[model samples]
Target: MEDAAMEDGETNKDSEVAPALIAVHPTQNSVAVAVGSDLRVFDLLGGCAVSLVNDSDGSLHKDSIRAIRYGANGKLSVSAGDDKLVKIWSTKSWRCISSVEVIESLLTLLAVKR
Candidate 1:
């Protein structure tokens, strides 16, 4: 079965902060988790935090990541945050492709294939 972050308390902050959001790739064996200002990709079966979120500079969201979703055959991922930013990332390279600044604070985001 497909899954996402099945393990509990994998991160010390798991208890300190509740998961803001969770998104399982529609066709992939991975899960995206949002905690505080950080976003982590986890192995569905292994249930371990992966490095898909890591970057040479730093985190993707400046504030808490409030929403996450997969688009178009799980090839694209989107994240929105309290920082008032919406970001799109490519699942292939895990690199950011574009970003949009929202005038109003963002609560959630849903990306659909066109």
Candidate 2:
């Protein structure tokens, strides 16, 4: 399958690639996307407008994002991928807060609170 992946060490660019997976923020009405080796988010506050993320550095992920999910009533978003890492981001800034490495391929994931 063809995937539109950005060049190495590259961050945001035109989304020419088809997304591998998608998750909706339950209360935020936003969407999280797993596109190629990147994870992008679109905040639907008004229309379908979106902006590039991880603009500060090309540190979003090293491989294609495999899964994404929202939890805590849309306050937090989680993403995982072939990189064997699960990243958690805050909804307020869309900034990554933590990273946890695993030993398995992250083909699917979920984030929830008890």
Candidate 3:
């Protein structure tokens, strides 16, 4: 049955890809978008793309980013997704300051902090 499903190009729920997500800065100066494993930002003031700096050795998110949020004060941003990693960013510098792996058991705690 599994082989037949594969041959028919049927995809399981777990294998389904997520839709792109968009987040606007609190001050409405910029907007960030997550498409697949790529992250893009646009400057509302300049009417151009904002180049982001990732100090890490690899891409921001290894998998699709499911959520992107900005702090109420417009000073910080967060991104998390299927890669099982959460990242904190500095909105001023547009740089990633920290990243942590997500543990299934601690998911509740993380959500509560958000």
Assess every candidate by TM-score. 0.71, 0.69, 0.80
Question: What does the lDDT come to for candidate 1?
Answer: 0.76
Clashes of each: 0, 0, 0
Q: Note the Cα lDDT for every prediction shown.
A: 0.76, 0.72, 0.77
Q: What is the Å distance of residue 29 in model 3 from its true position?
A: 1.8
Q: Residue-wise lDDT of candidate 2 within 21-96, one digit each (tens)?
A: 8788788767877777777787778656455345434588787787788886788788887777788887878777
What stretches of model 3 exceed 4 Å from their correct place? 6-15, 105-114
Q: How big is the positional error of residue 68 in model 1, measured in Å on the Cα after superposition?
A: 0.5
Clashes of 1: 0
- lDDT (Cα, tens digit) per residue for candidate 1, span 1-114: 223355543554445543578888888789888878888888878978776643434668887787888896888889888788888888887877788788876566565775
Give model 2's TM-score versus the native structure: 0.69
Better of 2 and 3 by TM-score: 3
